[model samples]
Target: MPSILLISDIHGNFPALQAICTQHPPEQFAHICNTGDCTVYAPYPNQTLDWLRTYQAISIRGNTDDKIIRLLKGQTFKKPGKKEKRIMYTSTAESLTSENSAYLLHLKKKQVLKLGSYSLGLFHGSPADHEEFLFDNTPEKRFQEIASTCKYDIIVTGHSHTPYHKIISGIHFINPGSVGRMFDGNPAASYAVLTIDEQARQKIQVQHFRCHYNTEEVVNELSRMKLPEIYGIMFKQGKKLN
Candidate 1:
């Protein structure tokens, strides 16, 4: 049997990331894959990127990650509607260390991994669009279309911040959910353990897990960092603070 740990949307909340790492050490799995959104809206993007680089996790560039990179390259999100998010991206981009920024700069937008007989496709969102979200309620026809086009047995994604596993058109679609942010009214860190049994007819199994962390601690830290109050409210309520 071989296992891979799937994680995503670690929006710079080091504490929540720490909780997941503590519970499911990366070494325990054959490989660790991060779908994306490794930075933004949290206080420790540098620490988060450092951890991923240290573990050599297979990572893809998420939408927010792209935003940070662009911001570093003198791009600005000056649109009136993006004021809060612009602050987040600018601050996060400025906080990155040179080493970590370089690390983030080299990440691919998508990756395909071959684990023995199984092939896995990793993306921050849907295969076609890095920011497109595929949820449980996404039309079956859409998934069928993706299955027809995507060339992997298992497709892993992030960005929705919601954990789910669905098999459509004989393809396994898995989202490990958000390690740093949860939008489902639960303030715990979320991740998934995917196991492949070589000998079993049903070869793939995914276990979604949530580890409890101190949400208020992150909330307080956000205050110290002078980020928007909505982020703290989102952490406290475990949902979008719109």
Candidate 2:
């Protein structure tokens, strides 16, 4: 079986990121792909970048990645409320190296791959837009429409910070979810492994997985940065802080 790892939306949670890396033998997987958001939301943006860089991710730019890159390149930002803007700006200061910033800047919006009979398209959001997040809460008809627009047997994406799988229009759409934030009623860091064969051409195995980390580490780091304390609770609760 040809194997690939799908990771996404790692918003600078170092503990979660490191746990996931240790769960696997790097040589076992043929490739690792990410759907961006490699930084933001918590502390350790630079550390997370270093981890991904060490792994040599085949990455697609998520909205957060794009936004950060723009901000780092001296563009203006307006997301995350006024307080968050200040916090994010302060935290990311000196976090992005010139080369890493440029790497995020040049991340592809989409990726297409062909191996024997299998067809794959990878995007951070939807096929039409990198910022479009495909998620479990989305409408079924909308998924049908999105799947139809793409001419591939399998589509991979991330952004909702949740991991899920859908079969539509003879197409398999997969979201490995967020590696950093599961602030959606599940605290475990989530990802997926996809195994498929081109000659068999008809089978795809998607394994949605979650791994726990020392939430306090991330929380403490965030607290140290004066980021929203709720982020700490969110990591502990596995969802948005109540």
In terms of lDDT, the best-performing candidate is: 1
Worst 10 residues of 1 by lDDT: 76-85
- Global lDDT scores for all candidate models: 0.89, 0.79
Error of 1 at 93 (Å): 0.5
> Count of backbone clashes for each model?
0, 3
Question: Which sections of candidate 1 miss by over 4 Å?
Answer: 78-80
- Model 2: residues >4 Å from true position, as ranges? 199-202
Worst lDDT 10-window in candidate 2 = 84-93
lDDT of 1 by residue, 1-242 (tens): 98999999999988998898789887898889999999988788988998999888999999889878787778765442557767888888888899988888888999999988879999998988888998878888989999999889999999999899999999999999999989999989999999999888978999999999888888898899888889899888889866
- Quickly count the clashes in candidate 1: 0
